[model samples]
Target: MIRVALVGNAGIGSQDHQNSMYRPAFERHPRFELVDTAEEAEVLSIAVPLAERGTAVADAIRAGKHVLADKPLAATLAEATEIERLAAAHGVVVVPAHHQRFGAALRSAIAAVRAGRVGLPWNVQCDFVVAGGDPAPTGELVNFGLYPVDVLRALLGLEVHRVHATGTPDLVTLLLDHEHGVTSTVVCGRVPALRDVPPGGLAVHRYRISGSHGVLAVDARKPALQVRTTDTFGPVWTGPGTVDVLLDVLAAGIAAGRAALGPHDAVQAQRVIEAAQRSMAVGQPVAIGQPVETGE
Candidate 1:
């Protein structure tokens, strides 16, 4: 069996570990075994606090285990870089848990875009808003906000060249310049009024891609997709149930002897996030893929 260990007890891991460990989906999988500690596993999943992710992932790598970390990679670019370097040196795979990457709704939307159903996507709009909760932690972006940013990059197959951002404790807006001249605007926030939607209720993370042909909208909240044409607009059906697809991807990567997110890709994403932070700090657009002067 492919031994796997979960490193965090929060959010999905708390529920997933309990449910999947007991359910046939994971328990009966002929190629897997979920262990309680990294010490007994060939692969580790780090789903802890943002600050601890890098250290935990690095430790697992040092111990010769493949690692799958939840998104945003690490709290800062530096830590992410270190983890990447160490993982590479040790020849361990480090895959970020970008579960949305494997979503059928999202995959379908991207496929439609690529098939020219939406033409050449020029502008993109995404909203990841949810009700209730305190402002995100100081100096940190919201958990789900990163979803759109990363998704835009993946769908477009481009890197963010520039970023302009503004926000308050509870809300954030980001304007991104993509490689192909595509512009993306992402608005994310947690409003107290939305709290009534239920815990994990209607956490609306959706995107609208506008191209020369039409518009394609995908909503993760209801797990649906909408395509707008010149004469008609309608919803497209997708698979049922919320699958932890990333975990399966992680498992497959480990079994195949590969890292989910290579060092370079992880670093690049972190750099984009860091640029957004800098843009917010200086109240100006920040150019990505460039060196910034540091006092230290």
Candidate 2:
């Protein structure tokens, strides 16, 4: 069994609730034993906000423990890179919990693209937005935007070359140029909850990929289940048994002594987001793919 230490479930601020969500998963997993402090566990599951995540992961690494961090890893690309370097120096595994990649629609899309069913993907369009929950738009972007960016990279094997973005954090659009001649356009941000939905229809997440031979599309928010109540109704956003899936991946990665979603991937995703934020701020495109200097 892997002894697990869960870090930062203070549940006080923005993403602190994320840390608490994993408790049930850990409690139920047969292969995991939840410990109170980082010192007692061989692995650490860090679900703190982006700003606090780097410190948490670094602490875990210094304690000679592997880490599974929540998405985005760090608020800035430079910090993500620093975390990667630290993990490397310590010879510990550190990974992001990009649960969206394990979703059925994206998984099928990847399989089709790799099987040449979509022929060589040249252009992709993605929209992932949700109702804002009392945070700055940029923070929400950093929190959620990393999912699609990671998915695009995994599917196309492309690295971001440039990013152009506009609008506030509540609503923004991005044009991303990648290697391998692939391009992606993303429009994502939080907005006020829309009215007139039957409860489950408010989701804004969608994607379309065009290749030489075919096109792949996914409505990530497409409701799979709906519940009716006296006063409200809504769809369940999570996939069936996805918690189990994530648990399985975590257990396997721990057992194998590796990270399924490593720090390099986190940095790559953060680079696109940081570039986009910069692009919007300066009203110009930001170039990417250059090596960053993370001074020790």
Candidate 3:
């Protein structure tokens, strides 16, 4: 059996090893075991706060354990870089738990895009909106808005070239330019009231990728995807539960002695996020994919 230790005790951590997210799958699988601490496992899944990720991962690596760290790897690029360097020095794999990358609907959409079914993606629009929740400890942008941005980046297989961001406590808007000439606008917010049918429910994340030939839209809240063509719209494609898929991937990567999200890739994503924050602060466009001064 592949021994796994869950590092946090709150929120996601509470459900980490219990299979609360995917009880059936965990119950059926005989190769995985969830333990309470890193001392008892060969793999560690760190689902703690962003500020704590680097330390948690470093500890696991120092113990000769592989890690599956939750996304936004660290609160800042410097911390992420340090984590990457440490993991490399120890020869341990550190995968980011970017669950959206494993979503079936997203996979199907990317396949269609790659197959020329969409005819060259030019513009992408995405939104992740939710109802009110308690104030996030990490603030709104990092707490909820990061998901759509991360998913968009992963689906496009393009690095962010620049970003223009603006936001209030309840809403955040980002216009991102990608390396492949693809431009995207992402909106994330928590609106006060829910519409009748609900414009998009709380916890709802959606995206529309438009190309020369057609458009594909994914409604992640319903956990379904739809492809629209000039002639007709296709059927909805359902996806697996997000948490379960993430855990399974983590387990598999650990068993194989590798990380699903490489250190460099995770750091790159963190840089983009930091750039977005800078854009929000300066009220101007920020260029990405280039070196910026980061405090070590």
Candidate 4:
């Protein structure tokens, strides 16, 4: 059995709630055991806020444990890269828990894209809003950027070249230009929860992908997902977005000595978010140069 330790939950402001959404997953899995501390575990599953995740991850890696950290590894790309380097030097597999990427259904879609069913996806559009009517729109970028960025980047498998964004907090749209002439247009927002819907119901999520031969689309209302509302304590994860899948992936990574998903893609997602924020601020397109390390 793989012994695991979980750190952080929902957000930075919230105290460490040991009854995390991840708890049930680890304890229920036959191959896993939930350890009380990082010292007793072979793997650390970290879901701390973006600012502090870097330190938590680095500490775990230094202790020679594999880690599955949450998205937006650190404040800046440089710090995120350094953490990746630290993990490499320690010879431990460190991956980001881009949870949605590992869902069985989405996995099939990814497989189809890889198999050339779509003949190189060149155009993509996504619209996702999971909240009530009123929310402070200013915080939407931080609240909404990571998941779609990760998903779009996975679909394209290329670095973004430029980003242009427009709209107020209630709605924000972004045009992302990727390498090799591929592009994506995205609209995202998250407000407080709608009391009308139950726990499993999310607002709206739609995706349209166009390739040379065909197009793939997914449109759903109230799909089974776990989302946090402004009023809720935190996101209570279940279904495909649960922490169970992340731990399963981590266990397999440890056995293979390599992670199926690495931190690089998540770092790329952060770069896209950074560029989009700049785009929104300047009222014009922002260039996202390829990531390079300056060994300073």
Best by lDDT: 2
Q: Count steric clashes of candidate 1.
A: 2
lDDT at 165, model 3: 86
Assess every candidate by TM-score: 0.80, 0.88, 0.81, 0.84
Better of 1 and 4 by TM-score: 4
User: Per-residue lDDT of 102-144 in model 4, one digit per residue for the tens?
Assistant: 6554566677777888897999898767666334323566556
For candidate 2, lDDT tens digit of each residue in 199-225?
212357778989999898887655366
**What would the per-residue lDDT of candidate 1 be over residues 126-175, giving only the tens digit for each residue?**
88776654344543253655666767876777788999889864678889
Off by over 4 Å in 1: 10-31, 133-135, 139-142, 193-196, 224-243, 259-265, 291-296
For the record, the alpha-carbon RMSD of candidate 4 to the native fold, in angstroms, is: 4.9
Candidate 2 local accuracy as lDDT? 0.76
- Model 2 scores a TM of 0.88
What are the root-mean-square deviations of the candidates from the true structure over C-alphas?
6.2, 2.8, 6.0, 4.9
How do these models rank on lDDT, best leading? 2, 4, 3, 1
lDDT of 1 at 174: 87
Displacement of the residue 208 alpha carbon in candidate 4, Å: 0.9
28, model 1: CA deviation in Å? 7.8
For model 4, the stretches where C-alpha displacement exceeds 4 angstroms are 10-19, 133-138, 195-201, 220-242, 292-296
Give the TM-score (vs. native) of candidate 4.
0.84
The number of the candidate with the highest TM-score is 2
